[model samples]
Target: MKKPIKDQKMVIFILLSNVFTAFLGIGLIVPVMPSFKDVMELSGSTMGYLVAVYAVSQLIISPFAGRWVDRFGRKKMIILGLLVFSLSELIFGLGTHVSILYLSRILGGISAAFIMPAVTAYVADITTKEDRPKAMGYVSAAISTGFIIGPGIGGFIADYGIRMPFFFAAIISFLAAISSSLILKESLSHEEREQLSSNTTNFFKDLKKSIQPIYLIAFIMVFVLAFGLSAYETVFSLFSDEKFGFTPKDIASIVTISSIVAVIIQILLFGKLIDKLGEKRMIQLCLIIASVLAFVSTVITGFIAVLIVTCFIFLAFDLLRPALTTFLSKTAGNQQGFVAGMNSTYTSLGNFFGPALGGILFDFNIHYPYLFAGIVLIIGLGLTILWKEKSNEVSL
Candidate 1:
């Protein structure tokens, strides 16, 4: 009895640690990727493809990953994901060729597909309705903390060598895998697994099911939100490098500062404000904020102007992510794994298109990616308004 109680306390901590490590690994690459592109003589479109391939891999695997989380239990998937993430990072660090980099990204995407649904479902399992907002706040904090630290470390470490950050990311992720294997316990029982397995469906079935009127609007919002953010973010380092002649360290400083501010706000305001305003309203507010900031990003000329616009953009994204997750979790009921998986799928789809398009836009004109991102957000906001108005009429 005491052991079960103890495991519950430790589980969230271990899960948060893994989340941090995963994001940290992702953030580390951002500061150095432009340098890698230059060294490889890669085109903007090629770089965008590199990012898109990861999302494509994840998109293909997400349905299966969702089912596996329910059938296989979350702990097993999390451990497997960490191991794969470590391997992918190691490969990326060692490989000199573009082909090797693509292979590494594919593996990384597969690992993300495994990890995200499992982790989210596990958290949903452990928390009650009232505690969920706070729980998600903690999750976002972990991610933001990783963003704060990863690039900071990567930027300074790149002085030693560009590949050093990848090697370091690999090492930390491997250690995290080992730690999780030892410390993390399964959140779902055998009986629970059997129950969930009985309700499982294939990828297309899940996709089709998600389009039912109950879920369609929310899922569309998720896709648009992800698309706009990814388009802007994927090109950001490249944009800074090209337009402003910024170094890796400069990019790292801007990101680190913004992440720190966002995390602080997330800690103080995210859960309480969500409780007060509700997810739908918060989502609307963030969409407006993000859309405006993205446009501002294109016009900004100096480091300070860029930093201010970037900070607000990051803040909007930070708040919007957990709000969307919380909204889905509230609606999911017994299908947490399924909903989480679909969420990842939609996000991957957005990520896939956003970066690919952003890269093409960047090649043609560096300002076009931000312009594209703003336009997508405005479209999303319009849809959100219409959806809500329709929903209210039905309720009436």
Candidate 2:
């Protein structure tokens, strides 16, 4: 029989590793997309479509994955998701056709559907309510670190060849899968798993019952944040190339710098920021700041101006992300995987609309995506205002 596992830190480490691995693979592509488009002879809309398809696939899979993570156990789902993530990156490296890119996105989306909830649920399982925020801080830090660092690293690797980063990302993901399989223990007990199976026999029923107003608002906020950011991503490289005549490496540098700012906020300032602003008020402030920055992006003309705005954007985004997630988790209580999955589902919807809309708008005018995101954020801020008196979550 297996010895009873002891340290919670090990569980937290494994979850952090899984998140870092997933995001690193995703981020590696951000800096290299311009090169890929030139090689593939693709347009802005097609690029946006690629991003949208991934979200669409994830949107379809997330709710099911959320329930399944609760049912099948977190460790198994995370390993499977990581393996698929590796396969998606491998496909991206191997493909000469655009169809392969689409296929890879589909796989990536499916992997996200599984991994997001499983890892989130795993974090909840390993920590007490008092410790959950700090645990989540580590989780957010790992994700943001991978996201910001991955772009610069990918750009550097691309000096060898653009496809090289994809191949390398594949290796990184595969290794994460191996390490997790060897070292990570399942969060759910056998009895809990059995009882979960019997109790959650009706997936739709359980999903319906797990609903709450805070969950709904959390979903909407996730959607809004993703929608606004995806617009910037969909068009940033294109915008830089068109307006400022920036190179791929230059765009990578900007992304890397912005991400560094974000990672710093995620790690160093999360609690202090929340404590100082309060979660409810902070959420409102982030939305307003993001909307303003996103709008400011449309009118800015130079590389340095854009870079400064981008850093602030990342900072606001980082603060907003963990704050909203912590708020949602505090409300989620026991059904961590399912609630987290729903969060992913709403995020996927935003992802879908963001890229698709951004791409469509890009074909018309380059600045439209940024303007569009600003509008979305404004709407989100209005909703946040309405949410003020209702969500009385004073402290976290």
Candidate 3:
């Protein structure tokens, strides 16, 4: 007998809670990172490498993590990831040396590689095809809220002590994990489990087959997005301090506002817009907007201009992500874990390269990072045009 449809609202709540913990752990550290570097007497290149290390770890582990999620189930992976994340955050809280900090980031990256894709795959399992985009939007909104609030709270507390943010993040992760363990139900059936377990294909073959053209395009787009964002992150604080005469507090405020705008757009408008405009067009439009705003940000000097341009950039990113996620999940069909894994891999690649390149460019000039990011975004946009044409041709 077919099971009755589960309550969507409850599932979304659980998913959002999961997202909150994930982003809170990551976002809360952003403002304090520069301060941490200053106190530790680290160079810009070291800081960039610190950021890149997370993604590098994720890239290395994602393929195996994906297969494990497919074989073991999303619920298990989520719980395991949370546990790892919580422990890593605790270590980060107690860390005294740069090497320890690097270890913490590596651990967090592994946990993130597992948690993020697993959570999204679980959401895909629960929602119907018609409702998937809306579901993804809500998840994205939850992520955005964390991005907004986490940084603000972290910045406020980091003024008191750097370790405080890490402690709070650990607490949040633990609580979230406990909530998920109690409330989130298993969505996959015995038959699905059997299929996954019985599959005998070689891992490489499964991977190649699982990655369709649309999936590749989506991965590329996400890669570009991550690359650009990471580059900005690598240099934004230095740029503000050196060029704009802004304090760390000011940079934190700017990021907070940007994330707030992102949350509003993702929660209030993204679903309706996706329903009306379709995912492909909305993604393209967002890419164009992000590219323009990125360029504009290069020329702007004041806090207000930074805030305004960042708001637009965040809005575009908010719109772009859910749509891409929806596209990836839909294309994955039954292989949700594999697709999610691929997404994680591409993002990791972006994270690895973005900061490294940004640091290299920053050696020459702070503005070079943003300017290069703007150029890369334009290139991504151009690729989107090719993607569209290819998609149309395939449809015909």
Best by lDDT: 1
- Give the range of the ten consecutive residues with the poorest summed lDDT in model 1: 387-396
Q: Model 3's lDDT to the true fold?
A: 0.74
C-alpha RMSD between model 3 and the true structure:
3.4
Task: Extract clashing residue pairs from model 2.
Answer: none
All candidates: TM-score: 0.89, 0.89, 0.86
List, residue by residue over 72-191, the lDDT tens digit for candidate 1: 999899999989989988998899999999998888888878887787777877877666556665775685576446766787778788998878878888888898889877878999
What candidate 3 gets wrong by more than 4 Å, as runs, is 1-8, 128-130, 144-150, 185-194, 200-203, 206-215, 271-280, 326-338, 389-396
Give the poorly placed runs of model 2, Cα more than 4 Å off. Answer: 1-8, 147-149, 201-214, 333-338, 389-396
Write down the TM-score for model 3: 0.86
lDDT of 2 at 235: 75
| Order of quality (lDDT) | 1, 2, 3
Better by lDDT, candidate 2 or 1: 1
- Candidate 1 lDDT at 160 equals 80
**Clash count for each candidate, listed in order shown:** 0, 0, 0
lDDT scores in order: 0.80, 0.77, 0.74
Worst 10 residues of 2 by lDDT: 387-396
lDDT of 3 by residue, 226-333 (tens): 788777766776667667876657877888878777776676887799898887788889888888877787788787888888778877877787788877766665
